[model samples]
Target: MLAGKRILLIIGGGIAAYKSLDLIRRLRERGAAVTPVLTRAGAEFVTPLSVSALAGEKVFTDLFDLTDEAEMGHIQLSRSADLVVVAPATADLMAKMAHGHANDLASTLLMATDTQVLIAPAMNVRMWEHPATRRNLAQLLADGIRVVGPNAGDMACGEYGPGRLSEPLEIVAAIETALGQGSLTGKRILVTSGPTHEPIDPVRYIANRSSGAQGTAIAHALAALGAHVIFVTGPADVPPPQGVQVVRIETAQQMLQAVEAALPADAAVFAAAVADWRVASSSGSKIKKDAGRLPVLEFAENPDILATVSQRKADRPGLVVGFAAETDDVIANATAKRARKGCDWIVANDVSPATGIMGGTENAVHLITAHGREDWPRMSKQDVAARLATRIAQALG
Candidate 1:
């Protein structure tokens, strides 16, 4: 999707600066031409030679080099790219950008550029949450700059919170979203993600190995393409993407109700691993542990959310996509599921312990449509989601 696009990557100083190298390679792999500019502090972490080598272009550093300025003026340099990306945007750099300071080449380009700018911030938890930093962030947002992540996780300082830079593939996905042709701009999409927890008692419950990473990524990708997304999510470790309406649920029945409420959308993606069954009669309180006897529990089938939505006679979505997570005969089972559920498409992935696709960062899926199964290569969940979102957009059109 980024073929022939010009990307101006501004490297900021931080421990996560290394990830920018991978980001450059990934963008180049997708046929984007990269121009790298390094801040003075950024040079402390990564060498100009390394940046130049990875980008296959000269690294711009000095703001007052007469020869370089004669060749390409700073104003032209700033305006040449389709997009400006600042990775590891430190607190200092952010403040400078927010206040329009042009003390350095990086800040000057950021101030002078007219193109859309995307920033990925990396800092300590305290620094990220500081009132000054928060104000700067708000200013950037008000100025229409797109911010990707300062994901909550362990930082280089050995502390954990919202200060980690997003992974390389995630940054790539955001860039693609910013540059996509808006194929799904006018569509309305519904997606369900995560694993439903069936309560056995107030304290204990039944759940699965679904992290909802893939499904949540799908919703974000759809929204990035300008689609109005109604995201019905079960309990997940990760936070939901911004700019999309989210509905929270904890059980199969709740998910079904949420999906029903979001009907008449252009497409539906049943990616949540809804429980197969629930406790027939859940205890109001925690069950007491007996000295020698095991408690007897009864199971009852949960509602078939995907099948119900796909087979709806009134106010049905134009297209329905279901996910089949299987241990054996993945494609065959998914094919049967597509036929039985009457969904327009089925995405099948093997979740056996041996495969490790479940709750993992990557996936290999088969897209089962009326024509045949199209096997995709093993890739990051974000890539898988973006590709699937694009396909849904095309199908909707």
Candidate 2:
């Protein structure tokens, strides 16, 4: 997708810096010409020699190299690339860019360049949530810079809660989305993701294996196509796309409320794996276990979010899409789901243990519409997302 693209890769200092080498190789494999610019601290984590070797290009380190300056002016060097990418963008670098500080080659090139800047932030959980970092991130977004990852996982700091850089493949997907032509421009999209946690008590909840990858990717894909996205997600492993308005929820009831509030959208994709049942009367306090007997729990059906939206009298989206995760008769179930939900389309995938679709990277789905079922070959969730986004754009148009 990035064939012939000129990519300026700026590696930042962080434990995630090693991942940048793989990023460089992947970019090159995709026909992207990479120019590595290593920050001093970044060099501490990953050697310049490895970066150069993987990128198949010379690494630029010094901010003021007389020889480099004579060959290619700083201004020219900064503007030479079609896109500027900062992988493992540390807190320090983000702050510098936010404040327009140019003490180093990376920051200087950032300030001097007119090309689009895309960053994949990597930091400790605390640093990521700090108010100052939040402010800096907000400012960067306002400045129209693109950001990816900072996914939630066990951090190098031995703590958890968001701050991990996206995987190399995920970063590549983000870059592709950023560079792709805007196909959904002027469209408004609503997407729901993740597995709703049905609370049984303050500390206990029932959830699913949904990581929200497919839905999140769809939201990013739609946003990349120029759609203003409203992403309603439950607890997810990945951060919401940078440019979208994310409405976070916990329980299925909460998700329904959030989705309803985000009505009047051009299209709505109900990709969330909302729990079918929730505790009928959740205990206010934790239920103590008794050695003699097991605790009894009552359950109630959760709201049918897709059906409600699809059958809305007013402000119903032009197109409503639902998802069916089935172990058998995937197409039939999906077709029936589309009819039952009154949604315009349904994406059905087999999540049987044998298929390994749930919580996995690739997905094989059937797109069931009013017209007919279109079976798609197994592909990465990113590919499905891109194609779905394009299809939504065309349908809206």
Candidate 3:
């Protein structure tokens, strides 16, 4: 996705500097040319030799070196890349960037750069939450500098919270979006996929024929357009897409919880084939069939995730989309569902046995909205996802 792109990577002082090694390799693997600028504090964590070897380019460290200055001036070097990225953006580094400080080679380049800037912050939990750091962050964001993550997890300081660097692949996804200048950049999208499994016993569960292909395609499409996708998915036949924050779940209730937790999104697409009912009293152990008699089971309605979110008075997404996988009366059923669920739109498709769409790749869908309905031609799931993504960008543009 980053083919032919130039990324000027500034490594800052922090434990996360080690991840920059993998970041360099990932960017190169995608055909991007990386130029490394290592800070003095960064050198304490990772050797310049290792960074240069991975980047396959010279590592710029000193701003006053006569040879380096003569070869490429600081201003030219800073503006040479398509984007400038600071990995392990420590508190000190962020402060300097916020205040336009140019003490070292890294900060100097950041201050001189005319290209787009993206930062991945990594610090102790306490440092990240400090009021001063928070102020600096607000300033950087106000200046339109893109920020990726300091995901919450166990930190090197033996503390846990939002201070870990995002994974390399996640950053790569963000890079793709930034380079694409996608319309949905900075938008947070929530997507649900796969068939939820409702447990009946320790060894048995009920599920549908959903493969999660469509939902995975949707998440990938949104991410490609620079949207941050929170992919809440059930166990499926296929793996979730890369470049997304994935929340794995098994039942309708769990999916609902995950979705609610990822709220305040700009938009949400509920595509999972969630079962309507679950075993009212699931057996802790396997149900024994010693006799020839069949066992009776009680069922209870599962939580209505779509309606719940659509009707939410707080943290409701600006645009809510629901899906109707119908066997009959495709458009009518879906249209009614759109009104019943109070969602802005409904993507309805026939999943009847005759249609072969339950687990199939292609889909012929009808889009139902307050304005009207649009019957779309049958197309590959990927194509459908692309179309939907474009429509979403238009709606939220």
True lDDT of residue 375, candidate 3: 87
Model 3, 148-218: lDDT tens digits are 88778898889999999876765775676667568898999999999999999989999999999999989
Q: lDDT of all predictions, in order shown?
A: 0.91, 0.90, 0.91
Model 1 has an lDDT value of: 0.91
Q: State every prediction's TM-score relative to the real structure.
A: 0.75, 0.61, 0.56
Worst 10 residues of 2 by lDDT: 174-183
Evaluated against the true structure, the overall lDDT of model 2 is 0.90
The model with the greater lDDT, 2 or 3, is 3
> Which candidate leads the pack in TM-score?
1
lDDT per residue as tens, model 1, 1-397: 6889999999999888988899999899989999999988888999999999999999999999898788657888899999999998999999998999999899989988999999999999999999999999999999989888878877779999998988777787778777764778888899999999999999999999999999999998899889999999999877888889999999999999999988889899999999999999999999999999988999999999988988889888999999999999998999999999999999999999988899998899999999999998787788789778877876777
Instruction: Identify the superior model by lDDT, candidate 1 or candidate 2.
Output: 1
Q: Which portions of model 2 show Cα errors greater than 4 Å?
A: 186-220, 227-324, 328-348, 353-397
lDDT tens digits, residue span 1-397, model 2: 6889999999999899999998998899889999999999999999999999898889999978998888656778789998899998999999999999999899999999999999999999999999999999999999999988688889877899999988887787678777765767777889999999998899999999998999998998898789999999999877888899999999999998999888889999999999999999999999998999999999999999999999998899999999999999888888888888899999999999998889987898899898998887686787689767867876887
The TM-score of predicted model 3 comes to 0.56
